[model samples]
Target chain A: MKKNLSEDFSMEDSLEQIIQEKNLVYRPTRLMTGATLSYCPGCGHGTIHRLIMEVVEEMGIQAETIGVSPVGCAVLAYDFMDVDFTEAAHGRAPAVATGIKRLWPDKYVFTYQGDGDLAAIGTAETIHACNRGEQICIFFVNNGIYGMTGGQMAPTTLEGMVSSTTPYGRNVEQMGPPLKITELVAQLAGTYYVSRQSIHKAATVRKAKKAIRKAFEVQKEKKGMAFVEFVSNCNSGWKMTPNEANQWMEDHMFPFYPLGDIKVDGKLVKNVIQDL
Target chain B: MAKVRGAIVVDIERCKGCEVCVVNCPTDVIAMSKDVNSKGYHYAYMEHPDDCTGCTNCAIVCPDGAITVYRIKN
Candidate 1:
């Protein structure tokens, strides 16, 4: 067969070729609402949302999955994701997810939260739910700042990270150190799987998706709480271009919120074990 | 070695012109189109199709989920 009989095979032509040849490589997952996403350019929330939805679609749980959308940048996640979603007050997603999981034990229940909602306002709910082993999945998007609330410093904001409130960069002396919520939750015996992943690069995106899938699988097994943290970038809040923010995240965010599983099967992962 | 060919279809209107896909493409197969979409932002286009190795790096990094990649191995 002739590879390309046409000199100029435009994108449409290529798409048509793919349809005719049945060689589809990568297409948008069905779980996405297909509506234009509201996230700012280069925001990691969209990437994280797509990854989770991709996992949901692949696992064939679109109808059975219930997501708790917390107050923060991704509060409107339900508009983008096709799954059933319940809106929770600021930092209360885990508590809401706990209720849903308890009522519908067979359904896949997950909470999508941001650092401001998860690490700061929702810390108590997050810790308790995980500690109690709610049999739910928590997808935390830690962009280090309150992205939707005009770039306020979040609990996960790093030292020297500047925000509207911390105009001079976060001072460890005054503001205290950034909270390692993933590690804190991983310490609990009720947690079964805990991992921190990022979507800064293609390789990392693949890894993040895999982690999300694993977390969902753990939830399916009726295991304890499964938490996956996505150390993300807020380009608009950080006052940097999408590209620059990504570079900044790699330089600064990854060092503090290093990626990998902290715990698996109620024990510290090999990397964390070695660190100890 | 047989030449590896790839193609990417971008939803022009859905693209916010973040350039995440453009910068992340390993093979330089994509570029922002000179034409603007209805939203007045320049969308991405396959400026050079033959160079694409179908690595799917662009699709992976696109936050808007605007690009779809296809590959043909000869």
Candidate 2:
């Protein structure tokens, strides 16, 4: 804390200087509960959670917003976020979110889902929700493998990525290609906006937050389904340290999943969006 | 150009001591505290407080949302 000092300076002057020098510019949003997050150190889930709550708080939609928590690592999202939430079975968040959104068309509704929950078991629910043009936002956290279920191979796992189930690295010929679920959803005519983002770097976090805020705005506009997929890291699942996982993700994940808007305003995003 | 000063407050109890903030800080302003929090992890502190530019990079990278940032222009 900085203070003003002079022969004539009063305590009030010092207090005023302190207040001016230390005004808060950024902090955790009140939308998050005080409970400590259970995610492992450096897990992207925490960052994504903060970004979502920050967006919701900025939009002043906490009271009317309804979120659907999937059965994966984010299953306990309701406990952390200070908003209305409905629990969904594994991969069924889209279905649940669709129901809530259809009933209360004015309320902002979204789904917090993981790759395992959405791509593997809930693929149908996810595709159908977007296909039906449900007015909702879908926040998909794709950390490649199923972090909660002991590092099992998920539908979004990279072709050569190693998981508990794929001890020798995934065989592309046998396992098929990694699922580009976000691209698939973008291809549907119902989606209004679709983007793939990450939170590993500070600049990327800002972009991801903007993407989420745009998706929320789309929901408020009564636009079709807005899907924002966050390609994240799972340190424990990958058996790597937090820093190492982030480095590994940058080197490996970005090559395949990449990042940028796949669709915007119900039209295909320009091809120039792809990274070299 | 105006001089830049930055302030940061880390919720020690809420911090998991992951050090993501420490690593991401551009000015080397943050460091692991010698003292541990309730969770037995060494929380982060502003080791070089005067060096902070208030860029908010540490807060942006903090996974636990434990840090808040403030900036002053002089």
Q: Which digits, one per residue and each the tens of the lDDT, describe model 1 over residues A58-81?
A: 999999999999888788999999
lDDT score for residue B19 of model 2: 79
RMSD of 2: 3.8
Highest DockQ, which number?
A: 1
Model 1, runs deviating above 4 Å: A1-21, A270-276, B1-4
Task: Give me the candidate number with maximum TM-score.
Answer: 1
lDDT of 2: 0.86
Q: What is candidate 1's lDDT per residue for B1-74, written digit by digit as tens?
A: 22336677898998988888878988887888889999898889888776877778998889989987777755
DockQ of 1: 0.54
Residue A148, model 1: Cα distance from true site in angstroms: 0.6
Q: All candidates' lDDT scores?
A: 0.87, 0.86
**Error of model 1, residue A154, in angstroms:** 1.0
